[model samples]
Target chain A: MKSSEWPLVIFSLAIQLSAGIMVIYDLFILFPMYRSRVAFPSKYHWILLIALGAALVGVIFSFLHLGNPTNAPRSLSNIGTSWLSREITGVLIYSALLMGTTILHFVMPSAGRSLKWLVDLTALTGVILIFIMSKIYMIPARPAWNSVFTPLGFYMAAIVMGASLLLLFQINHGSWASQKSLAILTISIPVIQLAILPIYMSWLGHPDFAGGKGLAILLHNHLIAFYLRLVLYLLAIAFGFWAFFTIRSDTTQNRLLFAPALLAWASILAAQIVDRLLFYTQNISPEGF
Target chain B: MSTFGFFCDTSACSGCKTCQVSCKDKNDLDAGIRFRRVYEVVGANWNKTDEGAWEHDIVAYNLSIGCNHCENPACVKACPTKAMHAELDGMILIDPNKCIGCRYCEWACPYGAPQYNKLKGIMQKCDFCRDYVLEGKPPACVSSCPMRVLEFGPISQLIEKHGDNRSVYPLPDPSITRPALFIRKHPGAKLAKKLNASIINREEVKE
Candidate 1:
C-alpha cells in the first residue's frame, strides 16, 4: 500500500472501532441493565469518552490523508452524490451527538436519563457512519473493493475491535454482570471475520472479479501483507479465546486478567490495521494493471 | 448539453508517444505525471503447422488515451469537495481551489485519468483544454499527434462520425462510466474474450 494511505487505514479502523464499541455498549449493557444498575451511567460516561476519543483521532487522521487539509470543510459539499461526503457528514453528526451525551453525563447526570435519545442518536449515527465509510471504497472502478466483502469486512473489524476494547474496560472495572456472555459474543466476532477470509480471497482470485493481473498482484506484491493480516486475525482470535477462558475461570476474581485483555485488544486492533492496509493496497482498479 | 469527448483511431496509432510528450510539455507535468498515455495492448501465441514449422500469431496495437470526459463521471460523483465537476459542455474539470486532494476521484475513475500532482498538492487531469477549447483551438495532445489518430468534439458528432465502439483490450467495460470516448478498432484488436491479451505498457504509463 502507498505510505500516503496509512492515515486512511488508521482513520477507518479507529472510527469503526469507536462505532462498534458504542453499538455493543448500547445493545448489551445499557438497554438491558441500565435502569436496575446505578453504576451504568458512570460506565456509559467512560465508554462514550473512549468512543469519542477514537472518533476524534480518526477525524485527525482523515485530515492527514488530505493534501490540502484546509479545504476539508468543503468535503461535505457533495453530500448529494459522494459517499465520502456522506461519510464525513455521518461521522461529524455522530461525534457531535457523542460530545453532547458526554457533556450531559458530566455536567448534569440527572439530565442524562432524560436525554437518553442523544445516546441512541449517537449510536445510530455511528453505525450509519461505518456503513458510509465502507461505501466510500465500493467504487465500480476498483474491482477489489466493489463487493459485499468490503462492507462485511468493515463491519467485522468494527465489531471485533469494539467488543475487544469493551471487554478490556469491563474486566478492568470489575463489572461482572454479563461478562461471560459478552466474552462469548465478542469471541465469535473475530471467528466470523476469519470465516469470511476464504470467500474474499476466492472472489479476488476469480477471473471475472479481480482478473488475472489483479490476482497476480495480490499473490506476488501483496502476498506478505495479506498473509500477515491473516496471521494477525488468527492471533487476535487466539487472544480473544484466552481472555474469555481467563474471565470464565477466575471465580475468585483475584487472578490477573490484564495480560490477556491487553493482548486481545492489541491483537485485534493490529489485525484491523493490517486489514485496512491490505484493503488499500489490494485495490486494483478495473483499468489498472 | 454539448458533451465533449475523445475519439481514438487505434488502427492508425504508431505508439510514438508524441501526444504524451505534448501533454506533459503543455501542462508542465512532473516526471511521473502524465495526462495522456499510450498503452500498448499485445497478444501472441504460437502454433505448430502440419509441416512441423512453428507459426506465430501476434497482435499488437497502441491506445492513446486521456480523460474520456464520461457522461456519468464517477470522479465527479465521488469527489467529496465537488472539485471534480462537469462544465456546461460536459467536460470534466478539477478545481484545485476546492480540492482537498484526497484522491477519491483518482480511485473512482475507471480511465485512470485523475492524477495527483504532488507539486501542487491536488488532483489534476485533462479539462479538454478548456482555455484552448474556449478559444476554438484543439487540445495539445489532439493537435500534436504525429499519426493523426486522435480526435475530439461533441460526443454526438464523434459518434456520428465514428460510431459508438469504445471498448478495447485492457480497458474496462465502457458502460460503467459511459465514457464519451469512441474508437476505431485496430484490424488486429484483441477482443475482451481473449484472456491472453495483456497490456504491455503498464510500467511506462503508471501515475
Candidate 2:
C-alpha cells in the first residue's frame, strides 16, 4: 500500500473501534447489568473518555489523509449522491450524540429513563456510521472492494476490536461478572470473520467478480499478506479463548489476565490493519483489467 | 445544456502517440501522468487453412482516450466535495480550491479519467480544453493528430457525423456512464466476443 493511505487505514479502524465499543458497552454493560448492581458514576466517565479519545484520534488521522485539511468541511456538500459525503455526515452526527450522551450521564446521574434514550440514539448512529463507512468503499470500478464481504469484514473488525478493548477495561476494574460472555463474544466474532475468508477468497478468484488482473494480483503479489492476515486472526481467536478459559478456571481473579487480554487485542487490531492495507493495495480498476 | 464531445476514427490512427504527448505538453503534466493516452490493442493466433497452409488471424488497432465527459459521470456522483462539477457546456472540471484530494472519484470512474496529481495534491483530467473550446478552438488532442483521426464539436453534431459507435475492446459498456465520446472502429478492431485482445502498451498507459 502507498504510504499516503496509512492515515485512512488508521482513521477507519479507530472510528470503527470507537463505535463498536460504544454499541457493546450500551448493550452489555450499561443497560442490562451495571445499572442494577452498581451506582459507580466514574466508570461511565472512563468509558466515554476512551471512546471519545479514539474518535478524536480518528478525526485527526482523517485530516492527515486530506491534501487541504481546512477545506474538508466542503466534503458534505454532495451528500445526496456521494457515499463519502454521507459517511462524513454520519460520523459527525454520531460524535455529537456521543458527546451529548456523555454530558447528560454526568450532569443528571439519576435520570435513567432520559439517559437510556440518548445512549440508544448514540449507539444507533454509530451503527449507521459503520454502514456508511462500508458503503464508501463499494465502488463499482474497483472490483476488489465491490462485494458484500467488504461491509461484513468491516463490522466484524469493529465488534472484535471493541469487545477486546472493553474486556481489557473490565479486567482492569476488577469487574468479572460478564467476563465469560465477553470472552466468548470476543473469541466467536473472529471465528465468524474467519468463516467468511474462504468465501471472500473464492469471490476474489472468480472470473466474473474481479476479472483477470485482480485475480492475478491477489493470487500472486498479495498472497502472502492475505494468508498472514488469516494467521493473525486465528492467533487472536486462540488467545481470546485461552484468556477466557484461564480466567474462568481461576477462582482468585488473578492479575495475569491482563497479559493475555492485551495480546488478544493487539493481534486482532494488527490483523485488521493488514486487511485494510490489502484492501487499498490490491484494488484493480475494472478498466485496467 | 449543449455539450462538446470527441470523435475518434480508429481506422485512421497509426498509434503515433502525438496526441498523448501534445496533451501532456499542453497541460504541463509531470512524469507518469498522461491526460490523454493511446492504447494499442493486438490479437492474433496461428490458424491452419483448408489448403494446409498456416495463416495468422490477426487484429490490431489504436484507441486514443481521455475523459469522455459522460452524461452520467460517476466521478461527479462520487465526489464528496463539489470540486468535480459539470460546467454550463457539460464539461467536468475539478476546482482545486475546494478539493480535499480524497481520490474517491478515481475509484468511481470506469474510464480511469480522474487522475491524482501527487505534486498538485488534487485530481486532474481533461476538461475537454474548456478555454480552447470557448475560444472556438479544438482540444490539444483533436488538433495534434497528424492523421486527422480526432475531431471535436457539439455532441449533437459529432453524433450526426460519427453515428455513435463507441464500443471498442477493453472499454466498458457505454451504457454505464453514457460517455459523450464517439468512435469509428477500424476494420481490424477486435469484436466484443474477441475482447481478450491484449493491450500492447500496458506499462505506458497504466497510471
Candidate 3:
C-alpha cells in the first residue's frame, strides 16, 4: 500500500522521536550512571518501568493510523498476503520480549556472565525487530518502497536520527565522551547512507517508478520541488561524508568533531524528515475505493 | 462461484474520479480516506536524459482500483489476523473489528486498497460494496462512474470484454498477488513493439 499522508507521517515521526528519546534516555543516560557506582535515587526499576511504559504509549500511538481501530486484532488474519500484519505481529512479539528482558534485568541483575550473554541476545533481537520494522515498508509491489535498499535505508535513517538524538542528550548532560561516541556513529551512518542513497534514489527514479504518486504530486506542475528534494538528499550525503572524512583522531579530547558531527547529525535528521515527507506525500494510492 | 471483475476503458475515462467518489460514498468511508483513487500519469521526463531534448507525450490514464479479488491474493495469505477473506462469489472482504491495524493487507495489495484507520484500530477495504450487490444492486463505484470506466461483473465476462490489456506495465507478470485487472492496449503498445523489433535487429547486427 501507499504510505500515509504528510500529516500522518509528521504525527508518527513525532511519536517515534519521542519514544526514541525516552529509549535513549533510559539506555544511554540512566543505565550508564547506574553502572558507574554513583549514588542515584531509587533503583533502576523506575527507569525501566518508565521506558517500557513510554514504549507502550508509542505502540498505542501507532494505532492512530488505522481506519478501523476496533478491528486491530484481525490485522493478523491476512499474514499470508500482508506485510503489515507481520510487522504488527513482530512488534507485539518484540515488545513482549523486550518487556520480559527488561523485567529479568531488573529482577535478577546478578546473572553475571550469563547476564552479559542474555543482553547480547536481546540486543540482537532488538536489531531484528528494527529490521522487521524496515521490512514493513519494503514491498516490491510499491516500487517506491520496494528496492533492496529501502529496509537498510530506513534502518540507517532511524539509527542516524536515533543515535544523533542520543548523542545530543549525552552532550547536554555534560558527558565528555559524547563527542567521541557521536563522531563514530555519525561517521558510520553517513557512509552507510551515502552508499545506500544512490541506490535508494535510483529506485525512486527508476524508469518504472510510475507509482510514486506522492513524488509525482510533490513534483506536480513544477520541477523545482523535485530538484529541491534532490539537493536536500545530496546535502545530507555531503554533510555525512564530510563528518566522516574529517574525523579527528583527538575526538576523545577535542570539541571540533562534536560541533560538525552534531551539525551533520542534525542535517541527517532534517534529511530524514524530508525523505519521509516525500515518501508519504508522493504516493498515488491505487485509486482508492 | 462468483469471480468479481472490473472493466475500465481509458479512452472513455475522463479522469472524473466518479469511481473514487462513489466507492467512498457506498462504503460510508471517512474523508481523507480512499477505497478507490484516480491518478493522472504524464509521459516521459525527456530533459533528464542527456540529449537535452524533452518530449512531452502525456497520456491521461484514469484507474479506479479496489480489492482485485485475486485467485492468489497475497493479502489473504500474508494476514496474520485472518481479517480478510474471499467469499465464494470472489469478493475479498475485511472484517474491521477483527483487524488489528497491522496493515499487512495494505502491503500485500498491489492495488493499495486496504486502508488502516488509525483511530478505529483496524483495517477496512472495499468489499465490492457487496452489501448492495447481495441485494441485486451494482456497487456504488460501478454505478457512479460518469465515464463508465469502472464496471463490475463475472471475471469471464471481463476477460471477454477486454482480454489481457489492462496496464501499461504487464501487471506484475509473475502474478504473485494474482491481482485481477485488465489493461487497454494503447497506441503506445504498438510503438513499443516496433521499437523492440528494431532494438533486437540492431543487437543482432552488432553481434
Best by lDDT: 2
lDDT of 3 by residue, B81-163 (tens): 77677777767777654666656577667666677665666777777777777898888888888767777887788888788
- Interface RMSDs of all predictions? 1.2, 1.6, 9.4
State the lDDT of candidate 2 residue by residue for A59-113, as single tens digits: 8898898777778999999999999999888888888888887887778776777
Candidate 2 Cα misplacement greater than 4 A, ranges: A34-41, A105-109, A172-177, A249-254, B44-57, B191-195
As a whole number from 0 to 100, the lDDT of residue B62 in candidate 1 is 88
- Candidate 2, residues B45-151, lDDT tens digits: the string is 77789999997777888889899899889889999998999987788889999888888888889887888887777889998887887798999999989999999
* Cα lDDT over the full model 2: 0.82
DockQ of candidate 1 (2 decimals): 0.78
Per-residue lDDT tens digits of candidate 1, residues B1-207? 337888999999999999999999999889988889888888888889999999887888889888888878888999999999988777888889999989899889988898888877899998778889889998999999988899988888998999989877777888888888899988787543463667777888995
lDDT of 1 at B162: 93
lDDT of 1 by residue, A63-94 (tens): 99898888999999999999999998988888
CAPRI grade, predicted model 3:
acceptable
TM-score of each candidate? 0.94, 0.93, 0.65
| Rank ordering of all candidates by lDDT, starting from the highest | 2, 1, 3
